[model samples]
Target: MTTLAPASAKPTPSAPTAPTLEWVNKLVSFDTTSRNSNRPMIQAMADELAARGLSPVVLPNPEGTKANLFATIPARDGSVTGGIMLAGHTDVVPVDGQDWASEPFSPEIREGKLYGRGTTDMKAFSGAVLGVLPEFLSRPLLEPLHLAWTYDEEVGCHGAVALVRELDAWGIRPRLCFVGEPTSMRAVSAHKSSQLYRVTVSGLAAHSSMTPAGVNAIEYAARSIAFIRSLADDYRISGPFDESFVVPYTTANVGVVSGGAAVNTVAEKCEFEFEFRTIPCDDPKSFISRIEDQIAILRAEMQLENAAADICMTPLGAVPGLSPQGTRAALELAQALTGNDAEETVVYATEAGIFQRAGIDAVVCGPGSMEQGHTANEYIELTQIAACEEFLHNLAVHLSTTERNEQR
Candidate 1:
């Protein structure tokens, strides 16, 4: 991992302006929510980079609806090896049901805070990176600087799988990566793993009058839900605990469930979505396996009631947890950039885990607070944005050959 000196002085007149709320405002206007296509926003940023003599690689998803962008500021020697990566996701969560004081997509400034959908959850960091692109390009750095933008992070980190695969295939391993997830400009060293699953129950349908002839899908679904709650209780009382997190133990919950079409007729189908968060020492797949065992039991019982009864569990998404035990260099670098003496852990998951799993030492350090993300009228403080600009400046200086030389 690379270590940066204190941030340098403000840029010269020839350099681009420091990243500001104006850039974030433009990004929020695009409405690149995970449920919709993000190509428009991707193209817009790609075009901006293209105009500046930098070529960005666009890796589209299988449907061509979304994409990930990877671009590099070549080293002074024109080598693309061993640099730092500044990464973020382009998509944000939807604003369908949240109550908002104003339009969620339209960025607004109130009392020095920029209010918008992705302001804090993170287009602010992206904006800060964009603000300094010209200056980064103008300098002759010792190592390359890469900007990596992925999509569908709000949808269980789906886009990052392909993005990391592409980066790994590129054969030019970066020394480290900085994931700009909101940490109020503080460095985050760890977060819990997140896993989601959808369970579907199928059963025989019949009139309410003929009770035995029909299988009540909802009834069995409730049984499964009860078992899930028991698992949660077990974790709560168990010995596995990491004092760093707000919730030190693992947690499970069924977020969405649906079944019966009518009140009278016997339900023929039921479906429920559930998720779990696990500490770094715990394997999420272990919980999934237990749930599968419970599913088998229900399947057996349902089969006795109705031969046609069946149950299926499908994985929705998963993002690995990041642990700080082996990340001393990355942690030190993050602490230096943020000027925070103590490292912290967060409950909310970020792309840092994915990068860390892929063998890139990653740390989360960006502007704003997680409290503002994924909420109506989300915002980032102007001061936080200013701090990110300073961090970027230090990053630029850190990547320059003028710093003490040490092979990565």
Candidate 2:
């Protein structure tokens, strides 16, 4: 009879494997949700970079609760200028209401897909860059390879603004930037701009029975929202359409509204949040100006009813769109590396636009699909990871070739 191992005896636990997968697993285990601090993840990445003979720079938010990381693998001569940048955000959207088969933060692989909150949204691409770090360091290259990881990208690209400013001041601009934002590794040349704002309406509170005595804030707010919808309708029927985008034209929506204390009382204050996804030809500030015109009329009307009545509008965020005309170099490089002949555009917003505004040409190319991002049981296919690895390898080879040519 063949001897069998005891039931409780387990094969020596397999040593941690899949450096890329390991990085993804470790990153996913952290709940770096948009509202949560991402310092831990940044620290972990900084430690890994340091171990690889890199001096990672950390730019912390004023609160010191969040951070952005920038590290580089210099050229053979140790010069760190005019290189390619791989950029991704560390923050993932919240999983509060979404149902999931596995913990969103506890990564699980099934059917050749890794299920996790950030796996598809971005962390996979970040993992791939870090996974191929050794290969990048091993090669003698003519240009540096910079890695940029930011925080709070899901929250209107707030962190990237400061990070970009810092990079500009540091004078280490990259020749091109690849923003890894779930395009299934295809090169995306353009995307719409996102402009979010909130308006607060103020009125005098009183019992609902005395309707004439108090300014009804909610009623006024409803009117403003209707006007915004009308503007959206106008865009839908307008001629400034770009057929490349699914929406084609600019769009607006009132996403949130809060007012009224109770059924019997007139609301003293009302607050509403609205956004405009504008096309490249449209100026977001123009939207703001139009809204302000409407608000002025509302304010004038309210003042007639009650001199104390008022309204205030504040800009929450405004991220510019990446125009294809200025992104030719980035497009060509991404196409060459991925062997793709076609380019595409997206309706969604990304930090790529912000980077472009900072004078760095940017293209969106990464693993997984945006359709899978921010959804229940978010996942990325294993094959996508493999393809991403191949892309990184090709990038290394390309840089190596450039180095060789210069040396000759």
Candidate 3:
């Protein structure tokens, strides 16, 4: 976790006007993982916004561990009627255990592609937004433009919650939002929601020879895991979604599990983490409730033999799913800007759901392939960047058209 000091000055006149490539390089240099503080990156972005004459508000977590940066470029009319929000996360996933060809923090360009830890999983989009700031500012925007960069999106959609709260506190609601997640420049209208849970089972431990005298926590955990798997099967069968997504339905799986000490002694404690990605029509809490009911029955059976037997379940995190609400204006605008007639839905989750739930229409569209994200030697193709730049250019034109139409 290296923290670079924020630059005090604006980009030099000779510097490239577009912020894309250069900003991506700088952002990749910082290791802003969810576990590590993203303050430095937030500070750097705030400085950049300040240089553009826009004052950014830094909303930090209660502990000041991470922060969200928000800035608004007000319309010339001084009316706060409606605006468009550009949202991206500052934090990236951990690369600690992942193997890499080059330094994870250091970015490299090969075969007309940029390779780094956050090259696609979202820092690239953030860079793209910053890179186009000059263009955005140059235009006489009829409506405000809101820039929102949040943290801790990798671990769970936690940081965006703080940002949403801040927006509520300020009473600043945008009419539309774009979450620039990696979509290969296609417009994504819907995505699944993620619900994570940790289950803990506790039992009495004794010598293996005294099996009847001690309750086996691991065995109980195994039973509970089996039930969870069964529920996953049900989700797979009953869940509804568009067939465009890879899985085409809800999915659940166990991610991590830990328990036991010695081979000779009965295991005393067992804990496991599981997650489910559900369609918008599915209730995230239903999965937890079903599991809890099963666990209650299991606990009762265990308690009959040993009063010390216990089981606990807790929600680790939750990100609501975004469904296509009728026809999304943002999606239509994105498609028009990109000159694409077809649109698709993704199985991967993004902050779009949060924005949409807050009454802001949202769509996911950006450069880079999702396959490259979180992989060794991750990269976004140069062509993708070109397409994104064109898209932005077209978006500016569309805004101009809208303003002209309104004037008429």
Candidate No. with top lDDT = 2
What is the C-alpha lDDT profile of model 1 across 1-408, one tens digit per residue?
A: 344565445532322243455677788899998999999988888987898898899999999999999898899999898888999999999898899998998888788788899999899999888887777887889889889999999988988889989988988677788999999878889999999899999988889999799999998999999999999999999938999899999999899999998888899999999999998888887888999999999999999997889988999999899888774667777776666667899987889899888888888988889999999889988888888887887777777748654546
Better of 1 and 3 by TM-score: 1
Compared with the true structure, all predictions reach lDDT values of 0.86, 0.87, 0.81
| Candidate with best TM-score | 1
Writing each residue's lDDT as its tens digit, candidate 3 over 1-408 gives 211122113222322225677898899899987889999989998999999988899988989989999998777676454677889988888777777888988998777777898888888778877888887788777788889999888878888888888888889998778888999878899899988889999998999999898888999999999999999888677766557677877788998999998999999999999988987677777878888899999999899989989988888888888888754778876776676756788888899998888888899998788899878788777667666666666655555443243210
Better of 1 and 2 by lDDT: 2
Per-residue error for 203 in candidate 2, Å, reads: 0.8
lDDT of 2 by residue, 290-315 (tens): 88999999999888989999987888
Worst 10 residues of 2 by lDDT: 1-10
Candidate order, TM-score descending: 1, 2, 3
- lDDT of model 3, residue 401: 45
**Which residue runs does candidate 3 get wrong by more than 4 Å?**
1-18, 238-241, 402-408
How does model 3 score by TM-score? 0.92
* Candidate 2 local lDDT, residue 26: 87
Candidates by lDDT, descending order: 2, 1, 3
